[model samples]
Target: MPRRHTPGHLPNDRLTELRSSVRERLGAPRPQSVHEHTPDSTHEQTTYSAQKQTHDSVRGPRTAVVIGRLLGLTFVLCFATGIWSHYLQDPLPWMRFPTRPAVLYQVTQGVHVAAGLASVPLLLAKLWTVYPRLFTWPPITSAIHALERGLTGVLVASSLLELTIGVMNIYHWYAWPFSFRTVHYALAWVIVGSLLAHIAFQLPTIRQHWRSRPSPRRGDAAVDVSEVDTGPAPIDRVQTDHVPADSVPADHVRTAGSDRRAFLASVAAASVAVVGFTAGQSTRFLSAFNLFGPRRYGDGPQGLPVNRTAAAADVLTTAADPAWTLEVRGNGIVHGFSRSELEAMDQSTEDIPIACVEGWSTSARWTGVRVRDVLTRSGIDPHSRLRVTSLQTRGGYAVSEMGPEFAADELTLIALGLNGEPLDLDHGYPARIIAPGRPGVLQTKWISTIEVIG
Candidate 1:
C-alpha cells in the first residue's frame, strides 16, 4: 500500500512503523538518523515498488545503451585531449611540456577535434533514443530521481553549448561576448561532472541493456530486450509491464528488427562521414578525403597554412619596414639587430611541424638563429625562461612565454627563412618565433622582441 500522509510532522508511531517496514522489506537496517530532521524524508519511498511495477516507458534501452557507450567514449577523448591542449597554451605553475615529439600537440589536438566532430552524430542519436523517457510519469519519484534528471539536463544543455563553442572556435568565430577560451574551459568541467553524475544515476539501466537479446518472434510485438536480467522497471520487459497497447512508439511496435538496424547504421555512417572527411586537415595521409576542412594541410603560400595574415593583424606595413629590428632584452641589457644582421648570425635549419590549435599542421624546413644565442647576447642565461613578442600591436597570441626547456632547445629559433626563401608576410616575414611542439598561434609571428624572465 502507498504510505499515507498526514498534517504537520509525521507522528512518532507512523515514523517508527515506516522504519520497521523498510527494514523488513530490505532485510537490512536503513539508518534513519540522517533524515531525522526532515521526519518525512523516507515517506517518499512509499508506493515506489507499486508504481515501478506499472511504469510505462518507451522501448529502446538497448539502443540508448549502445549510443551512450560511443558518446561517452568521444566525451572522454575530447576532454582528455582538451586538457593537454589547454596545458600547452596555458600551463599552470610547475607544468613543463616536453620539447621533443615535435608533433605531440598536433596529434592530441587532432584527436580532440575529431572526437568532438564524431560526438555530434553520436550525441544526437543518443538523445533521440532516450528522448521519450523525459516524459516519464510521476517525474519526481524520489530525491535521487530529481537529482538524476537535473544532472541529465545539465549534461545535455552544457554539452550542446560546448560543442557549439568548439565548432565556432575552429573557424575563428567569436560572436559570443564572453572569452571563448575561459568559457569553453569552464564548461568542459561542468559537462564532464554532469556526465559522471548522469552515468551514476543510469548505471543500473546501462547494465540492464548493455547487450541485445534475441529478436522476438514475428507477430509477437517487437521488443528491444537485453541478454541480461534487468530488474522490474524495464520498458522492454513486455510481459510484466501494464503499458497501454497504443502507447509504444511505432518503431518499437514493428515485428522485425529492420527499423532499428537501419537507424543504428545511419547514425554510424553519419559519424564516420563527419569525422573521415574533416580529419584530413590533421591526418596527412587522408588529405585527399578532405571535403570541408577549413584549411588544407599543405595548401598555403610557401607550402604552409596561415591562420592570421598581415592584413588581419594590421601589421602589413610594420612587418615590412626594413628599419625594424629583433630586440633581445633582459636584466640591464638590450641587444638589437636588423633582419639582415640577424640572418647573417650563425643559423641552423631544421624540419619542424607548425601545428595549429584548429587541428591543421604541415612540416617545413625553418632556418634561423637559435633562441639561446639571442638570449646569451642579451646577457641572460641561455636556459632562462623568455617571452617572445610579435610585431602585432594587439591580441594575446602576439606575445607568448617560452619555458626553459624550449628556450634551451637548439631547435627553438627566430626563423628568418622558410623553404630556402625569405618568409612571406603571412608566414611571419622578417622573423618569427618557431619552437618544437608548440601551438601555431603561440609561434609569435613577425618578431619584434624577446625578453628573458625568471
Candidate 2:
C-alpha cells in the first residue's frame, strides 16, 4: 500500500528526512554539481581526455617533419658520394674521372662515411616518431596506401642493413657470408627507389605538418558536432567536436614548441659532431676533432697509411729479392730495368696525395720517371692503355689498368722515391706506380711488369 501526501507536505515516512540528511552529509551521488552540469565543463573534460590519448597514440606532426627532413638530406648526400665511389672503383668508358685535385676521392669518401654514421640516430628517431602508423587498424586505406606501406618496410630494412654492413666494412669486420660490395651496391639502388616512393606518398602529410601551430579545439563554432553510430571508435580516430577552447593551457602549448625546437637542435648538433669526428681522418684541418676515428691524417708507414703490408700481400720474398727487375712490354717489345738502372734515368718529381678507399690520405713528393717517359723509352705508344702487374703472387688487386688519360698524365709516375728518400720496403719499395686521382689500392706496389694493351 502506497501513502499519498498533500501538496507541500513532507514524506509521510518518518525515516525519509533522516536518510536524506545522511546521504548529503556523506557526499553520496546527487543529481549533478553546478560545474559538472554545464556544457563547457563537459566539453573541457572530453577535450583533455582526447588530447592525452592523441599524444599517447602518436608523435606530433611537427616532430616527424623535422626528423624526416634531416634524414632525407643525409640520405641524399650519402647516395651521391656512394655513387661516386662505385664509379671510381669500376669505371666505365663513357665517363672519365679527372686526374687533378688528387684529394677528391679522400674528401668524397670521408663525407660518405661520416654522413652514413650520422644518419643512424636520425633514422631511429624518425622510425620511433611514426611507429604507431605501422599498426594502424584496417592496415590499408586503399591500394596506394598498401603499396606505400610495402615501400616503407623495404626502405627501413634496407637502410638498417646498409648501415650495418657499411660500419662493418669500415672496421674490416666481415661476419656475413655474402659479398659486401655486391650486396651493398644493389641495396643502394633499392633504398633510393623506395625512398622516392615514400616521399611521393607522404609529401602531402609532410607539408601539412611542417609548421608548428596549435590545432583547432573541439566544439569550436566552425566545426560540426556529431555522434557516430559505429560500435566503437578506432584508436587513430579523434573526436574533434568535444574539445573546449581552454582544454590545452597556453603554457603547455609553449612548452611543447620549445621541446620540439630543442629536440631538433640536439639532432643537428649530434650530426655535426659525428661528421667532424670522422671527417678529421682525411681532413687535415679537422684532425684535432677526430677523437673517435680509426685513422688519423699522416699516419702509418712513410707517413701514409698502408692497408696491406708486403707480408700480408705475400710479396715479402719476391719484393726483397735482388734479382727483381721491372719488365715493360709493348708491341711485341720487352725492356727490363733493374732498380739501379731505373733510378739512373732522368727523374721528375710531383707532389701527389695517396687517397685510400678507407678514407685516409697524405700528400708526398714522389720522384720517378713518368709513365709516358717509360713507354717512350720502351718504344711503346705513350697514349696506349696499360696494365700494371704487382709482384704480389695472389691478391684481388694484384693487377690494375691505366687508362690512356692516366698513362698520358705528366704526374703519373713509376715512382722510385718518396719524399726524396728511397721507397721504403713497406711503401711499395723498388718501384710502384703512383698516379694522380687514383685509389691507393690501384697504385700497384712491388711492380714486376707493365704492358701496353692498346
Task: Write out the backbone clash pairs for model 2.
Answer: 218-243
Task: Put down candidate 2 lDDT per residue, 1-454, tens digits, no spaces.
Answer: 0111211211111112222233445666432321234323233222322222223323444577788888988889889988988887777866677887776776777777888888987887778666655655446656776788899999999999998988788777889999888898899999999999988877755764566533454342122112211112222223333334353344444554576677677877877787778777777888888887778787876777777788888988899999999999999989999988888888999988887766667778899989898888899888888889999876678898888888998989999998879888878888999998877878999999999877
Give the TM-score comparing model 1 with the true structure, all chains together: 0.79
lDDT of each: 0.73, 0.71
Give the Å shift of residue 333 in candidate 2.
1.7
Q: Work out the TM-score per prediction.
A: 0.79, 0.80
Residue 231, model 2: Cα distance from true site in angstroms: 21
Model 2, residue 276: C-alpha shift (Å): 1.4
Best by lDDT: 1
Local error of candidate 2 at residue 96 (angstroms): 1.6
Which whole-number lDDT from 0 to 100 does residue 157 have in model 1? 92
Residue 97, model 1: Cα distance from true site in angstroms: 0.8
